[model samples]
Target chain A: MDTTSYNNPEQGNQEERLWNYIDGTATATEKTLIEKLIESNAEWKEKYRELLEVNQLLQASELEAPSMRFSKNVMEEISRVHIAPATKSYINKKIIWGLGFFFITMFIGFLIYGIGQMTFTGGEESTLTKNISKVDFSKFFNNTWVNAFMMINVVVGLFLLDMFLSNKRKEFRKQA
Target chain B: MSTGLNDNEIISKVLSGDHQAYAIIVNRYQNYVFTLTLRMIKSREDAEEVAQDVFIKAYKYLADFRGASKFTTWLYTIVNNTCITFLRKKRLDIQSLDNEHVFATADNIDSGMRANIVEQKSKLAMVNDAIGLLGSDDAQIITLFYKAEQSLEEIAEILGLETNTAKVRLHRARTRLKEKMETHYTEEVKNIYN
Candidate 1:
């Protein structure tokens, strides 16, 4: 219950450190520090002994395994189930990133293709140039109806995307 | 442990159409899985049925396992989730963890009801009943740590918690168990060991 030496300003919580040591998750330095504390601090030692008693009681009794046919029964059930081939379908971060990369790459490819095929012809045919040498801003943005449709579709598309991502997350959790 | 065949290999074999290979997986995990379901459902017959369904479910979902952790961890997750789902389907009276508060407030509980509860249970059975009375988190950590002999890291993986958090939870769980034992088995614990 004493809070004085219980804290290590740099290391973190002393109670958590003591627990980590007991659970075998502590670092070497922490183990040494906890050991020293246990040896020198009566309260720490008592705490350790008290927890160890609880651990002993917990480990003392375990629930019994099922009947002898447990494995056979399990096997029977397994036999009944059709073993499908291992699926590469476990949705994970890497797969989602890969899919994103594929879509981005495809979009870039399609953009390049569209640009390559664009032609400006008056009398003589002229291939499309990456740099636009015309002012078409009025045509693109001057139409109120077109602009309104574009804006609405963008908003609706974003809403759809959000819904899609949310549903995918839920599916991932339920399957995972 | 079966002929040096790891779970991954057995899984691979099963996936490769060696359907019988799943038997190895089943045998390897049967006891531990059975004990877990039994503790959750508190009935051998129901536990057996749930345990079988769990295995069948595991086989069906084996393809979904990407081996992110140990096989036991994945299998136990399925076992735990399946048991929880089964409990939901049955709609047992123990639907909420808070109901155990009734046991905690022993003096408020009817003597007849408590007596009816303890009538057939032996000391060990009483111990198990006390554990069942623990909230799911505490009961699960105690089982995974002590009964399953899982390390703190494994328990964390099982519960999807950070290691430090799992350690704290395990400590708190032990404290709760101690309180439960002291409350319910104050006489029995002393008598059984003496």
Candidate 2:
């Protein structure tokens, strides 16, 4: 328990052992070893007594009391502020999952439909332009589902763009 | 103010639109919260302000507390973070060099109070003064472990450290506190134990 030797390597190890023993976190072997050392070694016994006193002092320390009106002040402040509602009240997990399911299903469906329409003409002269030209644009657009999907895609794209631009404008205002 | 109701029950009532129920929660924990904030902040006035804010913030976010941990652990976490924020906003150099000076401000606040508490320096006053001499992190770990009686796991959760780290920190803080008592209050300690 010598403050002068606090930096000594041996002192540090001994303190750590004493702390582990005091906190009751030492293994059985460690506990036995510490007990033997404390019983036999005068230095270890002195350190043990000091640390035990420190532990007793800490345990007996009382919680500091605030002013008498503390709770009233806090309640008054609470009255002026907004309390957040429970998470379940505002955020619907089911709706989020439903939207996610809709998007994923649409993506997979589009992938399958795209693969089904691919005509693999295995010819040496096959070119990208020739394949694209063979696709009947009018027939593809003539499908009601495809037209409706395209309209939804445009609306979503525009909504995302508007959101992005508004965010940028807000950032600019903050900077300005 | 001792409402015989448990923390969870009070929380449930508060969430169900009974805001006055929060006063019970505040009353139950104000001393603990104030002690911890005062340990970190050093200034009783500012600590009181920060403690009030901690309660307000906790009430605002009450719905987010999910009963996964004890309410005291969650509340202490808020107290810890708010004090850190208050320290940062005050531009106190908590990281290095000026750390001692920042922590030493507690002496000005506590010295008079300690004097008036007892004519013969009591062990409790000596221990409190020794704690005031430690840096914020060390003081916080000691207070959480000793005063709050939080386990190593709960201390880790509150301080955002690993449990092992919290254990090490607690040991080191106790060591430093013992050293402080030895070096600073040697006469008082001897007089008290004599």
Candidate 3:
């Protein structure tokens, strides 16, 4: 509350020096000077005590801790990124295998359906020759019921195979 | 405090992909980081999320740490920056000493011990509300110096200010807090007398 000591040229400098000392920010010589001042002046001592009390109170206020999950969540996030690269290559390989299996199954089903159609007709050799000559082989293989049945079987079989493959993929993924 | 392996050793290990070494750094400063974040963010959920992000970012950029300062200082810098970013993105109002005056007057009738537990809780809520009224920089400096127990020099380093500047800011913040407290006490006294 006394501004004179902090404003007068000589006492003002000492007051500032004393403040730094009390705050633990003074250099060695300044600290020694302030110590001497405290020894000589009763007022400085009282000011020192008051400053310390304020500092202590400020320090006493507890700091709340952040959530307990902080460390775990951080580590988990970092590891998630780290593990991604390793699994990315595996995912790429799976995509290639899936595409290969899809095309191979389609080729096999086409061959099987073509052979079934050729065999169903009575003039087997002649039908085959005609089938080779006509691009529109549906005229010779115009049995709609048989064609429809074979198409249905092909779709059902592919569906079952897809389910089986997907199951296997899941198992493989789990193992990996 | 002198472990054979220094922060540099631990950081080098982390950069070489030895992630477990990171736990050492986290364990060392997690409390300080968490406390600072919690005080600033005010929500446990957001504080935890931000604190976690701070550490993870520190780890990712461990290589960028040139040993220009103490490891803890560097960590504080990151935490401070992260909290500021979060505050900005969320567009939270920076409360100043102005709000404390309002709180003090509004809750004047509920001062005595007879005010009950709920009233006590409201008092604390008002105090926190006052804190929330401080400007972002003021609130941060108050928390860093008072709550975190960081020296002015350490705070200066974290906030990238000169020591004198930090001291001035600290003085201003303390003055503001004291004023707010005085206003609250005066209001309560008036209500009691009335």
Count of backbone collisions within predicted model 1: 0
Of the candidates numbered 1 and 2, which has the greater TM-score value? 2
TM of chain B vs. native, candidate 1: 0.73
Whose TM-score is higher: candidate 1's or candidate 3's?
1
Q: What is the Cα-based TM-score of model 2?
A: 0.72
Clashing pairs in 3: B95-B132, B95-B133, B95-B134, B95-B135, B96-B133, B96-B134
After best superposition, candidate 3 residue B72: deviation in angstroms? 1.4
- Cα displacement (angstroms), candidate 1, residue A169, comes to 17
Clashing pairs in 1: none
| Per-residue alpha-carbon lDDT of candidate 1 for residues A1-176, written as tens digits (9 for 90 to 100) | 22232234432254556656777778899899889999999867866765565556566765667788877777776666775655665457798789767755765565454445544333343434533554234554555655565575578568779889977865674486
Q: Which candidate is the best by lDDT?
A: 2
Clashing residue pairs in all predictions, respectively, total 0, 0, 6
Pairs with backbone N, CA or C atoms under 3 Å apart (clashes), candidate 2 = none
Where in model 1 is the C-alpha error above 4 Å?
Answer: A1-17, A89-176, B1-4, B91-129, B187-194
Model 3 per-residue lDDT tens digits across residues B55-113: 88887667668775678778889998898899889987544324545455657755564
User: Each prediction's Cα lDDT score?
Assistant: 0.69, 0.83, 0.66
Q: Over 4 Å off in model 3, which ranges?
A: A1-18, A27-43, A82-176, B1-6, B93-97, B101-109, B113-135, B142-153, B181-194
Identify the candidate with maximal DockQ: 2
lDDT tens per residue, model 1, B124-145: 5765667777776677777877
